[model samples]
Target: MRFVSWNVNGIRACVKKGFLDYFHKVDADIFCIQESKLQEGQIQLELEGYEQYWNYAERKGYSGTAIFTKIKPLSVSYGVGDLDTEAEGRIITLEFESFYFITMYTPNSKRDLARLDERLEWEDAIRTYLLQLEQVKPVILCGDLNVAHQEIDLKNPKSNRGNSGFTVEEREKMTKLLDAGFVDSFRYKYPEKTDAFTWWSYMSKVRERNIGWRIDYFIVSSSLADKIGDAQIHSEVLGSDHCPILLELEQ
Candidate 1:
């Protein structure tokens, strides 16, 4: 089975930049996107043979997520538990026979760290939610998690430290989540690889120079670790500032 995740920035904007072309070429069994920044009825994607699911933010053109899967799931859900955080449409969960698939767009802590506290609360809530789902079956979680868990996950560790996405609190939350039983598929395969990143800054020459952060991820239950076939970063593909990442697992 193949799972792909990418933060499209904005689905509408990305479409014009060959999103569909790459989407068709990859042909992932399950394709998930974050930061869709869309509302209901805003766009329609003709994805034949794939069941589309979306969680649109209440506010127009804000945070959102979606999944397009070739296989039908037994059940589906939006949000994490009874949390009131769904207002931003950040999460979507799908229950298959053997796994619970979830995609999320983690809240960003603004440059001034305005949303740091709220982001931390979300971390705790989602961690608890993931654990609950893990009890039933292994979970496959993917999206723009919005944090670089370690120094090696970004381009300039020293300079980027304490920044919105690299703050100690944010990074620790990610560590705690992984300690709870998830495995970052890419790092699992390439433990020491450097300069590989997912999201790059939109500033001048940032993307061109490859100054980016590996904020997006494909995290699976630790139990599924051995089933992982390969984890890939399609840094060459572009539409948004973020590129797509893929994980292959033995079915």
Candidate 2:
């Protein structure tokens, strides 16, 4: 089965930038998005054969997520338990017969680190939520997790050390998540590969120079690790500052 995740940055903006073309070309069984920044009746996506699920932030044009799945799930849910109380519309979970797929737009610890505490609380809540799902069946969790777990996951690690997404505390939360029971699929396949990234800064040729952070991810429960065929970062396909990450797994 093929599953894909992309932070479209903004759905309306992406639609104008060949999103449909890329969507048709990829033809994934499931496609998920983060940072949609939209609400009901704002836009329409015509993806045939895909069941669309969207979680919109209560605040207009803010953080949000969506999922388009070819296979209809047995059940669907929004948010990570009490974390949904934040009103940022950050999570969506689709439960299939065999596994659960969750897409999240993790909170960013703003430039000034003013939201660091909230982000940490969100991390803990989401981790517990994933663990609960894993107890029932294997889980595939993917999205713009908003943190680079290690130096290897980004370029210029020393310079970005204490930055919001690359902070030691944020990275440790990611480490704890993986240590709990999940496998970072890309790193599992390419343990030492460097300079590969998902989100790039849209400033001063940073994207052109490939100065980016691997903040997006496709993480699965350890039991599903062996089923992973390939984990890909499509850096070239761009409408947003973030590109799509693909995961191919044996059915």
Candidate 3:
């Protein structure tokens, strides 16, 4: 089975940039997207043979996520649990026969670290939620986690050390999540590779320079580690500030 995750930035903008072409070419068993920046019925996609699920933020053009899967899940859920307060559309969970798939648009800690506290709270709640799901079945967690976990993940690591996505605190939360039993598929496959990134800053043609962050990911419960076959970053696929990441498993 193959799973792909990407932060398209905006679905409408991505469509203009050949999103459908890439989507057809990739043809993943399941595709997860984050930072969709649109509400229900705002855009129409003709994805045959795929069941589409979307969660929209209360605020327009804000954070959101969606999943298109060839496999029909036993059940689908929106948000983490609390539907009223969980209006950011940050999470969506799909229960398959053997596993649970979760796509998340993790909150970003703003430039001034203004949202650091909220980000931490989100981390806590999300981690607990993931663990709870893990108890029931192996979990595939993917999407824009919003943090570049290590020095190998981004260019200019020293300068970006305290930046929003690279802050020590944010990285630690990712570490804690992995420690709790998740395996970052790409890192697990290529632990020492450099210049391998999934997201790039839009400033000053940074993407052309290959100055980017490996923030989007496909992570799974440690139990599925042995089943992993290949993990890749589709760096050349243009559409958003982020590119798609792929994970293939024997499962």
Candidate 4:
């Protein structure tokens, strides 16, 4: 089975930039997207053979997530606990016969670190939620997690050390989550590989220079580690500042 994740900045804008073309070409079993930045009835996507599930933020043109899967899930859920009432439209969970698939658009601590506390709280809640889900079945967690877990995950790590996404506290939270029994599929596959990034700054020549951060991920329950077949950062296929990442599992 193949799973793909990408933060499409805004689904509408991404479509004009060939999102559909790449979407068709990849033909993923499940496709997850974050930062959709649209409300319900804003735009309709004609995706053949795929069941579309969307979580739109209450605040129009803001953070949102969506999942398109060829296989219909046994059950579908939105948000984690009381999070649905908060209205950021950050998470979606789908339960299949074998596992639970989750796509999340993690809240970003603003550049000034203004939202750091809230972001940390979110991490804690999400970790607990995943652990609870694992008690039932393995989980496939993906989307823009919004943090670079280690120095190896981004370019110029020293300069970005205390930045919003690279703060020690944020990174440690990610470490704690992994230590709790989840595996980051890409890093697990190629530990030493550098310049493998999923999101890049839209600033001048940033993406061109590959100055990016691997903030997006496919983290699976440790039990599914051996089932991981291939983990890829599709840096070449672009629409948003973030590119698609693919995870293939051995059937």
Give TM per candidate.
Answer: 0.98, 0.98, 0.97, 0.98
lDDT of 2 at 27: 94
Candidate 4 has a TM-score of 0.98
Listed per model in order, the count of residue pairs whose N, CA or C atoms clash below 3 Å is: 0, 0, 0, 0
The parts of candidate 4 lying over 4 Å away from their true place are 84-86
Tens digits of per-residue lDDT, candidate 1, 69-181, equal 99999999998777875799999999999999999999999999999999999899999999989999999999999999999999999998899999999999999999999
- Put down candidate 3 lDDT per residue, 76-153, tens digits, no spaces: 998876534258888899999999999999888999999999998888888899999999999999999889999989
**TM accuracy, model 2:** 0.98
Off by over 4 Å in 1: none
Error of 4 at 72 (Å): 0.8
Name the lDDT value of residue 17 in candidate 4. 100
lDDT of 3 at 104: 92
Error of 1 at 136 (Å): 0.6
lDDT for position 62 in model 2: 91
Clashing pairs in 2: none
Q: What is the lDDT of residue 8 in candidate 4?
A: 96
- Colliding pairs, model 1: none
lDDT tens digits by residue: candidate 2, 151-222: 999999998889999899999999999999999999999999999999998898999999999999999999
lDDT, residue 231, candidate 3: 98
